[model samples]
Target: MSRHGTAARLSFYYAALFTAVGAHMPFWPLWLKDKGLGATDIGLIMAATYLTKIMVGPAAGHLVDRHGDRRHPMSLLAAGATLVWLLFSLVDGFGPILAVTVLAVGLWSGIFPLGESLAMMETQRHRLDYGRVRLWGSLTFIASAIATGSLLTRQPSAVMVWVVAAALGLTALACWCLPTSVAAGRGKAPATPLWPLLKHPVFLAFLATTSVGTASHTVYYAFATIHWQAAGIDGDTIGLLWAEGVIAEVVLFAFSGWVVGKLGPGRLLIIATCAGMVRWLGLGMFTAIPALAAFQLLHAATFGCAHLGAMHFIARAVPPTLSARAQGMLSAVAMGAAPGLMSPLAGRLYESLGSSAFFVMTGLSLVGAGLALFLARRWDGGTIV
Candidate 1:
């Protein structure tokens, strides 16, 4: 495929997948509230998706790794996600909604690691820029977040069900066209056990700060929209707030190569952790538009840089053959266990402390920053050939 063809294909898939995410992340809590679930209930429900990642995400990544034909697993999982979300439009109760969310997220979560593994492979082979390609996802996220936020003004929150369902359906279709299939060594056993890899000091450190840094976002993810609403921000403005943050993230992804070349993944992670501390502290202490807007721009450092740092860590530390497995472990720890554990706590705290819950996140970021700084100082960059 031509370079443009490959980039375009990858960009399309990202757009499709994140279209649902853009809306789902910012407004799903609102939808849940519309359904009559309280803060604690919403927390548990959010946690359930992360919990699914813990139970099933690693195995799913293993399945993708075991087969060389990743396209099938990727497509099927995307299809399953679509099916689950479509069923959501029909359900009304907390139990059914919770059950559906857990199942849908499990199916949905695998697609990201699978896509990342594919992207990293292409980056190695084709000299395509990983950060540049990924920025497309961020760009689409801005569009999705803003569009969905606007829709909420004229349409009922229930309309969100259809939006999510449509996006997943599109995502499943996009999966079929994902970059030409990587060489699938059918029926081959994985050469090494996953546990030994985790025992490496560098790998262990990467996981720790990544998990903690990511966990710190739970307060924002779970409550920011609600908090903004209570503070008299309109829906469209809230959407813009989410979009503005992702725009910062997009900028980081677009220029990550230059940044990574200058500082390497260790420094990048340190920057991410420190930025997170400042961002969350500011978020907790202020609700005024200007303050929130300024802090939202820090999403570049909080989510964008942290993610690039983790990706760079994996690329450097793990064998190329084990990319999918590495992504799974990263997802399970940061995306699965930490967020799953912290999300519910954020909800409990949000209920009791109001916006003050962000203070706890400030502490989380501080710990992550301290740990990442130590790792950066001690661990020289190492790559497995």
Candidate 2:
């Protein structure tokens, strides 16, 4: 396929996948409430999904690596997720809902790592810019979140499951449309055992750095709005502040290739962690709109740059046969386990220290920076195995 064609195909997949996420995240809790579930029940369900990702996601990755193909497995998982989501309309009460959710999320969550592995391989082969294509997912997520919120003003929240299911069905179709030629491991065993990679000190350091860097967002993700509101910021302005962070992330992604080429993964990760330190410190200390907005722009470096660094690092430093498993483990730790562990801690800190709680996150960023430095010293631009 031409570069444009390849980018378009991958872009469509991301756009479709995030549409389901955008709708489900903001409104699913409301649906659970409507179904007569309490806050505790909802928390249990959400936590179960995270647990599923931590366990099932990596196992699925290992399977993909063994099978040596991404597209077919991705298609099956997406379609299965849609079918499971459809069960929501028929089942009621906490137990049934939680059971279905665990099953569905276990399947749905695998799609991300698999899709990412495929996209990175294709972009490398085609000499295409990954961020340009990935920006579509971010754009669609924003649109979906806004549109779903708007629609909920008139429609019953009961339609939430159907809406997400529709998006999942579109995602399944998009998976079918992905470039077929990019499968890196067809009928081949992974060159490195998963255990050795897991045990490698440098690899563990890579995980710790990326996980801590990403986890530093826990307090902000959980309570930034409440903090701003307590400071007398209105709903509209708070929304704008949140939008600014995502927009900054998108802008960084739009130019990711150039940024990666200039800095390399290790330096880019170090810069991201350093940016996080400054951002969290400012957010903790200031409530003025000017300071908040200024710090918010660092979302590009803290999240966008960190993510770019991780993706490029895996591409360069992991063997091709192990790529799927590597991406899976990264997703499992950075996105799953770290956030899962930090969320409750973040809530407690926010309760005790209020905005000062952000200082703790700053400390986490500082630790991430140190780990990144350690990783840079140990891994010299080559496969760890």
Candidate 3:
């Protein structure tokens, strides 16, 4: 393929992947409710997906790195995920549904880290802008979430399976379009255990900071729609709020090159961590206020800043050959395990303490900020490779 063709195909792939997540993240809980699962059950089911990702994600990454063929694995996983979602559409009861959700999520989560590894590999090879390509994913996510929310307002929850299945099928098709052979050497290094990576203090600090910051968003992800509904916001308004956050993210992603030049990765991490502290605090306390409409705009920094900082840091802190593994570890730890462990805890806290649960999230954000500060100090002398 021509260089432009390759980039266009990859961008489309990412767009489809993010659209799938956009459909799944905000609406899956509602689907669970439609299947007769209560809040606790929904939380457990969601937690199960995360738990499986923590285990499966690293393995998938290791496979991609060792085999040096992301496309095939990605395609297989996407197809399996689509099948699981289709199965979900068939089952009605909680027991069967939870079983299906676990399988589906476990398989589904494998696609992204692998796909991201491929994108970063391409970026490194071609000197392309990762942010520019990734921004489309954010844009598609925002668009899909709003469109899906509108669809759900008129359609029953059963349509979620169809929506997700279509997205997953597109993901599989995209993966098939990706190159099959590794661009770099495929020879295996002795399987370096993830333990050594974890032992690096700066890396650990990076992990902690990003993980805690991400975990702070769990309540909003898991319950923000329900919360807004209770506060008398209509479904369409809730959809707008969700889209507002991603719209800000898309804008941030567009300007990430400038942001990276100005702030550097270290300072960006600190900014993201600090903004996250405020974001969660705002969600906890001022969500009911009209002013929060403006505060939600900070999602650009809360998610976008933190994510870009982490990816850039990973590129700097680890070797190119290990880039996929590094990202997988972050996904396993930060996105997968931390939230997996915390979601149930947050659910309990939300039930007991209600909106005050934001206090817990706020405290986690403070911890993340502290970790970011520590990483900034530790890696200050190092240069990005």
Candidate 4:
């Protein structure tokens, strides 16, 4: 009944969600490397995680809409993901590993957007500060990323998957306690057509910008930890580099309400795209700490701003009944399938051009900025839905 209690529980769930991400996002490739996979193989594996969204995310969203509650499915997915992740310890071959990865990803991919849809509804109903509560997740992300990096300095590669499993275990426990006040469209007319949003010129413009622009970061997401290690950076500093970027993201989330009020989602997205261009290009050319720090600081814009704009855009433009499905679509395009589609190409470029692969990503980010800008100009001034 108390909003504060609900927010704390939500915050804990975020902490668990990102702890899994923080551990896996930066270190999974290293784990793959230790498994005797090449950069290309590693890229393909990472791509699979994103691609699984197409298979699972939208359907999960529809289920949530049908049931009118997110917590039950989230708990089931987290539990399944935990069991599947344990398979990593047993699988040695690439094919087996990919199979397990797909199972894990497809089961778990809908959790975040569903959690977000729940959080957004609470924010509207209870006037909860979405960014402030969300900041706890970022904090843990920093903690887990830094702690896991430190551990891997001496720990075995198996530690990576173990940490991921542990995090998922915690996520399953947290899901039971998440807010369940969200209303479902259950007992209403048949579900809303997602095609209407797809057909909207403005929404399509937004989707195009996100899908194409973020493709550039495929190199960084898939290989930055590996690249920096090859350049002789230690695990501690690599963790710090990851932390530095997320710290900026935390700052952005802390002030997200103000930022959204001032710039709106479209403008924020444009900024994110432009910053992404600078960050990826800089990473390709410079490996020095000062430069790396600068580029990492830009994570605020690249990831932080982009994400803030996305959630806000959904809140403002989409009807509440369609929130989960809309978020699933956003997740699939921006964070899921696009990265899935681009990572292999990034691997090819990385193998052929090494650091020069960043240049290609830079080009993609620029294209995203152009589309985002066009969308911003064409967008109607919208009130929050």
lDDT of 3 by residue, 1-385 (tens): 6678778988988898988988888878888877787777767777777777787878987887787778999999999998888998678776887788778988888887888778877866776677888998888888888888899889997898899999999988888888654635556752445567768787888888888888888887887777776787766777778888889988888888889778777788788878877877888786564656777888998888888888777766766567778888888988899898888887777777777887788888788888889988888635333
Candidate 3 stretches greater than 4 Å from native: 180-185, 188-195, 287-289, 381-385
Write candidate 4's Cα lDDT for 1-385 as tens digits: 6989988898999999999989989999988888989888988998998998875767877777766878898999999999999999999878998999999888778787788888888887888778888988999999999999999999997889899999999999998889785564553432666778778888888778888866777999888988899899999999999999999999988988898889998999999999988898899999998899989999999888888888888888888778888788877887788989999888888888999999998899889999999989988756323
Model 4: what TM-score? 0.97
Give candidate 4 regions above 4 Å deviation. Answer: 184-191, 383-385
Residue-level lDDT of model 1, residues 213-322, one tens digit each, is 98999989988999999999999999999999999999888898898889888988999999988999999999999999999999999998898998888888777657
Q: Model 1, clash count?
A: 1
My TM-score estimates for the predictions, one after another, are: 0.97, 0.87, 0.94, 0.97
Off by over 4 Å in 1: 181-187
CA lDDT scores, all candidates in order:
0.86, 0.83, 0.80, 0.86
Clash pairs of candidate 1? 68-184
**Candidate 2 per-residue C-alpha lDDT over 248-279 given as tens digits, one digit per residue, 9 for 90 to 100:** 88898888878888888999899999999999
Q: What lDDT does candidate 4 reach at residue 274? A: 94
